[model samples]
Target: MKPLSSTLAPGNGGAAGQTGLETNNAGRDMKIIATGLLVLMAIVYFTSKSYEEVHPALGFVRAFAEAAMVGGLADWFAVTALFRHPMGIPIPHTAIIPRNKDRIGNTLANFLKSNFLITRIVAQRMHGVDLAGGVGRFLKSPSGGEGRLKMGASRLIGDIIASLDQDRLGSMFKGAVKSQARDLDLATPLGQILEVVMKENRHGPLIDSTIKWAYRTLDANEYVIRAIVFDRANTVMRWTGLDDRLANEVVDGLYKLLADMASDPEHPVRTKSEEALAQLAVELKTDPALRERIEQWKLEMIENPAIADWIDGIWENGRNALLKASRDPDAAMAGHFGDALMQLGSSLQKDPILNRQLNRFARRAVAGVVASYGDNIVKLVSETIHGWDAQTITDRVENAVGRDLQYIRVNGTLVGGLVGVSLHTLGYWI
Candidate 1:
């Protein structure tokens, strides 16, 4: 009895005992049919030997036919056993696909990563071509780029305006204030600002008006002054028994004295206030306790609901300002920003050196980011490659060209047989 594999060999000229599957594949089908026909032919020749003694030439034909059947069946079995169990008997080491589908997928992934997605291939693709340039081109191009830029600007402004929630605004303000408190020495900035205010004479007019109001307040309250003076005169009259008219005269004089003191800008009280403020500044600067207290007081204020309310108001104001700017592009806020932007653009346009520096910085900044993340790209490929299924790799390749490869086997059989016969005839003639 022949082993089942020999007859199933798809292209080889083997024996007649090949399995039925060779007929299923297009290339192997004809070989299988021919194998069967050859077996029949051999059987016929031998059977004819009974009728008439057959020549040895017929025996050679019988040998060739038998061999072809064996080759066809063996090849057929070998191919079929790869994808399924032989005859569906579920034999061990057969039907590898269904048993290990995940492994197949993994192997396929690995093969792709190794062969198609290697680092050199990736690096070669990455070299010399300005990815940054492409993005810049896309953004800065004249063809609809200006429109896109405007749209992007509008969207950005809109999103910023919309995303300005109270919590976010509060957080931002809190951050700004906290940084100023911690990082900025308020005394210096405040002093400088106050100096500027003083230098500009902005505070002088206000202070002068306040002093003039104090003088007016005294004039308005002259009766209170007169009452004090009259009351003192009454006491003096009781002491000296002076004339009533003379006492009244003394009281009137005292009234005038009180009014003068109140009216004077160089009054002792006003001078003392200025001195006290100066002393307070010294304490704020030199006194650690005072500084600590200031910080504590600031922290308390920041935590206060008033601060939160102020943040809300600020956010609302900012939002309203932005909304106004967005709605009316020619509004004051928008106009100011536009003017500032135009100035900046004009400066960049004028300053060649500065423009080149900016361009270089922008390019380097992008390159830096890519260099930082490049390793991750490499790792992704390697890790993927290291985890795929071998069989899956094989199967995918086969599917891509499996039908084509079947022709190779068919052509090989025909071509090999033709060469064999030609050589055999050449030798016979020689």
Candidate 2:
């Protein structure tokens, strides 16, 4: 049975087959016409010779007919010899295409490799191609490359999502996160962050808030302060009535001092708080003992089983969410992927620098490949031609150019007749 493509093709004979058939038919038709003219000339020559005694004009007719037959026969031989020996007689230089098919093939291959497939020619042609512009137009078109890309990406994502082992991914993710955390030294970065905060005076607000909380606590617990003051008084003074009054006076004085400290921004206590923070920041950064302690604490946390469990839990939760989303057709992940592809296409179109780089790379890649494989291509062409039989080569060449060659036979017969007539007239006039 014939292939579907062959069956569905426009004509039973394809382009090359159709062209070969047409040429063969035309060549046969011209051969018949040329042969018929030759036969007609022969008949006329014989008839003129037979009638030459009856009329003097018959001599010129005989000359023209004889010359025309000679010309037609000569042209027919010349044309036939191109494909085969004329009349089956063995002749040199006959059937030239079949005789030198291998050499012809080699020459043709070399010519193509040198002229058409050279690195410079390939590069120049590649550079001239508007690859970026074509891509841009395809992506920009609604039903063109953009839609195809989206469909392809969707299928790929679906396949990948379906193929993933959730358990394996979860384990890998957990292991990777824990490994990274354990490998990282947290102390240096933390200290640097603290140093930056202190330098920018960001810790000032924190100190103020701490001070306000302390003041609130102290004010609310005045009775406790009073009892402590009374206990600290002399035993004899406590026994007298003046002890209570003296304790009140001391408590009031302490309250006044607290108020003054809190109200004044430049108070000694505020200055001391700022100084303490600065000192702490410096120690965290510069003090090796502090830094080592912080590192040790971080390592302890990382090494804890609880911390490992926590990391695993995070991975499990994330995996579950991802798997669920992947199963959903309307998931944002697929949409986001599509958007990203479109954006990339747009960038390739709009960004001249990127487009130029892409085109330059493409040209270089094509040129490099052509340079590397050109010899192989030439060899392939030569080998293909060499593989064909002599008969096949003869048929192919004759079919391709035979129709045009038939015209020479027709011209020769007519021209020879005219020349013969002119010569006969000149001879008679002389």
Candidate 3:
């Protein structure tokens, strides 16, 4: 038998390359050993046949050698037929792998789709996997040293954003914001917020601030008030100096009234202000006319060019900020992202209910993806294998199992020799 050459091409390196080279060498070596045994058997068979008349022992030796050669030749032919036709002849049932490569690819793809990629099986397998915990740990610590995973993720985000059309993205964002804003019930929420503020008496500080502002304004313009009072006075009052006293009285009275409102929480003006605010809040909540007006106002605001421009500005600023954060090495966005991930992970770890829910969600998500795209994935696998040339298919298959097949030849030769010797002994006795 001719020794089969190595299937692996030259200059192949790395673990995969080394593995292929090793297997190829092993198969080649075994093929040589098996062929050498066959040659030795052939030499013995011819020599023993020539000397068979000289000695009875030669008869048994000739029988064993003859049988061994036959067995080795049969096994070698069988093994070679798997990858290629024996002696390069286009024999029937030969080169089985190459002939059925496409079929094999389809069979493999269908088997994977039916058994492995099924939604139930995938979900079951994922059910036990703590994907969230794994993600959390990865986010919390630098994976494979020096935070490369985090940096890689940040760069990926940056690349995705960079690849996007900023103007289009901004437009979409603005549209979405307007859409949501249009759907919002502004009056009810405002009313609820106002109710909460009043319940907590948070408006007290605001009222006090308003009072103080008014007092300051009146004090600053006292001279103006006095001049106005003097101008409005009659001629007799001005000549008698009564106008000056009246102006001072008017200014003092105004200051006292403001002071009273500030010092007394239950003052008439304060009470009236609270009542007015309370009434407005109630009207916002329960008055249909008021609510309708608010809704109309909201619609108008949403439709306004100024609001559209604001939304555009917001989207631009946000998109630019995100892009900058993603690109900047010194930016804390990545660190913040990592920290948020870590916090979420820690929470998932600590909270059993949350962990279980998240795991269920993850499983469902994965199962959904599999259900949706499993056929496409299977088709991809089949098409990829089918695309390969017959020679490529033959080489890969032979490289994988050729060594084991060569062992069969060696075993066949020895087993055939023993059977031949036993048969010779039985025939002689008979």
Worst 10 residues of 1 by lDDT: 14-23
- Alpha-carbon shift of residue 403 in model 1 (angstroms): 22
By TM-score rank, best first, the candidates go: 3, 2, 1
Best first by lDDT, ranked: 3, 2, 1
Models 1 onward score TM values of 0.38, 0.46, 0.60
Residue 256 in candidate 3, Cα distance off native in Å: 12
What tens-digit string does per-residue lDDT give for candidate 1 at 1-430? 2232432334334222232234335444554554455456446546544544446554334344344444444444555565667787877877665566556556655665566455455455555545444434333332343555544455446555655575677678667865675665665455456555645646545556665676677668766755665566656665775545565565566556546545675767556655665566567667778777777777777678987677667767877776665544434323456556555655565666766666666556555654565556556655554454655544544454455445543444344434444554565679
**Angstrom error at residue 417, model 2:** 2.9
Candidate 2 has its poorest 10 consecutive residues by lDDT at 1-10
Please tell me which predicted candidate would have the highest TM-score against the true structure.
3
Among all windows of ten consecutive residues in candidate 3, which has the lowest summed lDDT? 1-10
**Overall local distance difference test of candidate 1:** 0.54
Instruction: Supply every candidate's count of residue pairs whose N, Cα or C atoms clash at under 3 angstroms.
Output: 30, 0, 0
User: Each candidate's lDDT (Cα)?
Assistant: 0.54, 0.77, 0.85
Instruction: Please tell me which model should have the higher TM-score, number 1 or number 2.
Output: 2
Compared to the true structure, candidate 3 yields what TM-score? 0.60
How would you encode candidate 2's per-residue C-alpha lDDT over 36-119 as one tens digit per residue?
888999999999999999998899999899889888888888888877888788888777777789999999999999899999
> What is candidate 3's lDDT per residue for 61-143, written digit by digit as tens?
99999999989999989988988999999999999999999999999999999999999999889978997777655545534
